[model samples]
Target: MDVAELTGTYTYRSFLNRPEPVDDFNKLRFAQLELRLTAEPDGTVSGELVFSEGEPGGDTIGMDMVGRASGASPFAFTLTGKGRPGSPVADFHYEYDGVILRHWDIGIGQLMTLAGTVLRAEDHGSGATLARAGQTASFLAVKRQA
Candidate 1:
């Protein structure tokens, strides 16, 4: 699938805990975020994100990314973001591969989930499958600063 057409705003929640190196930290919660995404024909996606609830950390994150896919194959993407203020931005990438969308003989049986959550596949009138785990189910958005 071409990455250019996949562009929209999404509302989401962000949950996080301190890494193993550090302990006793609180589990941070970021919710009710208004995130927008724009994918380009050249496999690049760029956009901005804003939060409507929780904390201000998610108020906006910068995202300049890319995704690649071949016919009938699962799509893959790489995205990164930086929180507002003193928040440090991080870069992460994941691929959606070998997904199955089965219903009455696997009509559209293959799906690709990015980073263990986001699901992308052929929207043909058929049943869809999560296929594998580790696919991110949430679409995150971040804005670019001028």
Candidate 2:
């Protein structure tokens, strides 16, 4: 997949693992994410996922995360992330394998531009799905605040 294809801002609600409670997935609500993906000729993607405390208009109370994905295609890729959640004591990092499956047939395929599902971090029994109408819904394009 090309960077321009996925070139846009996206909002997402992630279930953060509460390290103090043995890595439990807690509902991180009203959180927004901005992803800028650049496709490299080597079939790898370099990007940054910025996590904000509230909407873009609000103050950034949390940390900003950065990660990279490498794969033959964007549908199925591996991502590794590391960042601090606005705290000096806590650290955030994880690796996940994601695949874009057909919504009807469930067959592996290239992720659809502007519309698709991404399964990230499946360690918690089931991976999180970031898609339309989900708890985490992000605009694929950059939002220009007025």
Candidate 3:
């Protein structure tokens, strides 16, 4: 598929992979995410991601992402926190590796989906390093209509 096909807004959902005894603190973090992406002619993609709890009057966070797309199935991207210095998420960084999946949705007809694994590349809050990252999650993002 053309990289341009990925330029749009999408609703994203992710589930963290915790150990057997999952506790309240180890549950999924964000309630929802909105991804607004723009694909360039050079196969590079830049975008903004907004994360919300899906609750009335709840707070939301925004981050910036940059990555490259391939004509084949593979795509990789990294998300960097846009928070101020010393903030909880100031040093947050995540890397996502995924593939574009095309399928038919009963309600939306043909649907384009992004399915992947997310790695906690950097997490200052947890003092995570390359050898001992914080956590991993699986994510799925579906492009929204114009």
- Candidate number with greatest TM-score: 3
For candidate 2, write residues 1-146 as lDDT tens digits.
44334333444334433335543333433334665455554546555556545566865433343334343343554445445445431244444344433234565553342322223332222236322221222222232222
Clashes of each: 20, 1, 0
Q: What lDDT tens digits, residue by residue, belong to model 3 across residues 30-109?
A: 33688788887677888867754335785445567778777664544434334333434556677777778755456557
lDDT of 1 by residue, 18-126 (tens): 2455353233442335546676666666655443334556344533233442223444544443334433322222322222122244545422222223432322122
**Between 1 and 2, whose lDDT is larger?**
2
The true-versus-predicted C-alpha distance at residue 7 of model 1, in Å, is 1.0
User: Model 3, stretches more than 4 Å misplaced?
Assistant: 18-31, 52-60, 73-88, 104-108, 126-132
State which candidate, 1 or 3, has the greater TM-score. 3
Q: Which scores better on lDDT, 1 or 3?
A: 3
- lDDT against true structure, model 1: 0.39
Please report, in order, the local distance difference test score of every candidate based on alpha carbons: 0.39, 0.40, 0.68
Q: If scored against the real structure, what TM-score would every candidate get? A: 0.39, 0.40, 0.69
What TM-score does structure 1 among the candidates reach?
0.39
Worst 10 residues of 3 by lDDT: 78-87
Output the lDDT of residue 98, model 2.
Answer: 45
How high a TM-score does candidate 2 get?
Answer: 0.40
